[model samples]
Target: MKVEGVLVLDKPKDLSSTEAVEKIKRLLRVRKAGHGGTLDPFATGVLPICLGRATKIAQFILEGDKVYQGTFELGIITDTYDLTGEVVERRPVPELSAEEIQEVMQGFVGEIEQVPPPYSAAKYRGQPLYRWARKGVKVEKEPKRVEVLEFRVLAVELPRVEFEVYCSKGTYVRSLVHEVGLRLGCGATLVALRRLRKGPFTLEEALTLEEVERLQAEGRLEEKILSVEEALSFIPAITVSREMARRIRQGRPFSVSVLGSLVRLQKVARRPRVPWLRILSEDGDLVAVTYYPERFSGEGWAEMLRVFVS
Candidate 1:
């Protein structure tokens, strides 16, 4: 039996996200499997793995916000910003009041420039930064703009601080920890980290790899799978009639009036913004995904970015 859905794996620490995917592929005996996002081997938590046809929706999950709870050890800095690298620097941490620490953290709550960690997967030229770092080579890296929607220091212990972060895609928690330390006048390094949420999936809903293996042994793996449509719940969905669905399946576009009607109805019904639609057959097989730019002109209409089934 071929399985098509998302698997929210509770990744164990010390296993790269890719390694976890490989285990899932082997367990399920599926030819295709992809993780929504990559997690550092030292970090663990909710890692969504998509299998078979569900891989088509992996991009949607990757584009969503992520939440993490972790601790940063103060007074020491590592080359990788985490426990994986050697301490490159150490500084004396001055006695700071709770209010002062809170004030310093506030500065990181919005848009800011962040430099990728030297021991990271970021590419310079054609080689990964980690490869260069391993060779003791230094390369100039451009800073990237990343938003920190929420950054709160949950607990403060002299040399260790626990915090929760909610941020946009591509925001690196390791880099954030290093920068937060810079703001506090002391160096810092990530000692432990765990992702609590990724888009609509939460740690509460994730399963450990051991549990997945047990289920697979019992021949009940599919029972734990989440449908592709369910995994893409974060995106706006527009349901079409059977005729329109057929046209979409035939590689033809739908009428402009149909899209206008949806927009008008959504406005009157006070529905959440439906900027995009999921074209589905009457029996519920996903055909294509599309967006509207004013009028869904059939001449250059909603092009199918991904066509799942004919």
Candidate 2:
């Protein structure tokens, strides 16, 4: 039997995100699986793996904020901006005042423009910039606007600094570290990185590969699998009448008048910036991901982005 759910994997170091998903697939013996975020080979923690139907929600998961904790070495710059790349530049470590470093990073707390590292997976002309950087090709990438919700220095070792960051999706910590060094006039490079959270999932709730193997050996692997409903628990669910649920199951969009007393436009979606809502069947099973069209087409109905009826 196939299972549809999400697994929060505490990935071990030296494994790519795709490789981690493959390990989860092998452990569960599932044919279809996907991951919400990508972590570098040297990074670890909170990689959300979606199995079966949960794969449909991977993009939604990717849109959520992420938290990371890592250490960077001062006086060093690498081609990739991390320890994995060759040293491209080095500078003497000047005396850094605690207050000065804090103020510089604080400037990054709000929205800022960030130029991705040349040796990154950012696409340019339909090719990842990393490939071009590998061959010593030059590509000028425009800085993108990203939100850094929070950033704080945890420890200040002379040559290494440990820090934590909470930022919007696609915000690259390596780039952030490199930029900090640039501002200090001393190049820096990331030595270690671990993501502590992604979206609503946290590292504390993730199962390590060894733990997963042990559970499967004991025939209790299902204990770690989060049902599709639980995986989307971040989104509020609204129950629909049987007639409306039938229309959703049949992939037909219906008028809002058919919805009775419990349904109201403001109750389900009140703002013009509403993204998506959970539509449940009469039995409360999640049937489809719906969105109010009143904000767009001025229509009085919920449009289905994807249906999950089974």
Candidate 3:
């Protein structure tokens, strides 16, 4: 069957994001499918699977912030920065208060440079770092800046501490936890992690693999898939006339004046460098995703970035 839309999955532990997408594609019987973001096999929770036409917006979804609740064990350092890797070292857990832990986590807030763990999917010389690590050649990637919106310490139980983090896209919670352990004088390893939110998608609306299979069996799986317009509801949109829609599909340029009051640019602060506008048909079907040029005056013309098969 030809299907299109996003399916939020509560990915199970021990399953890679690619494997999850493959399973969903097979279950839904759709030939075109892709995932919005990558989740470590050891981590589980909200994983948005974009099918058919919905795949076009996957990059936008991946650019959104992510929220995760996780636990880390102090006094143990692992090669992967998580419990899934070989134990690198063991240290004594210093007697510390929850307030001290929170202070360290607070330091990580705002923009901070973080180094991806040696055993990670980060590329090195056109090969995954993990692949190099498996060959006994450890490679340390350059530090990258990632925004940590919130890093609240939820609980402290001596060796194990649980926390929740709200971070920008590309933030590595495992690396964050490892750094926290270092500051505490006891290296740590991530033991558990669950992604609570990704972009506009959340775990509350996600279905498990088994749940999806059952829904497919009942022939109601399609009902849960979110349409392209609904999935990109966070982006600004404008409805164009049938003729204008045709022009957009033909990759034609459009005058800003034509949009008039319909030209609803997102607030300046929230808008990305290159703005995206959803073009809709009179019947409300999404017709195209056009690029709204920066400094676009009322007299200029803008081009379409992607035209949908409407």
Across 216-260, the per-residue lDDT of candidate 1 in tens digits comes to 889987888998877766555566677877777777766656765
Q: What lDDT is reached at residue 104 by model 3?
A: 90
Show model 1 residue runs off by greater than 4 Å: 254-258, 266-276, 292-300
Better of 2 and 3 by lDDT: 3
How does each model score on lDDT? Answer: 0.82, 0.83, 0.86
Q: Name the lDDT of candidate 2.
A: 0.83
Report how far off residue 183 is in candidate 3 (Å): 1.5
Ordered list by TM-score, greatest first: 3, 1, 2
Per-prediction TM-score, please?
0.91, 0.90, 0.91
Per-residue lDDT of model 2, residues 81-136, tens digit only: 99999998989998886677777778799898888889777899999899988778
- Over 4 Å off, model 3: 255-261, 264-275, 291-303
Off by over 4 Å in 2: 254-274, 292-297
lDDT of 3 by residue, 1-310 (tens): 5689999999999999999999988888888899988999999999999999888989878888899999999999999999899998999998888899999989999999988888888899999889999999978689999999899989999889999999988888989999998988888999999999998899999999999999989989889999888998776677778987887788777776565445644232225422677778888888877665554555776666667877
- Write down the TM-score for model 3: 0.91
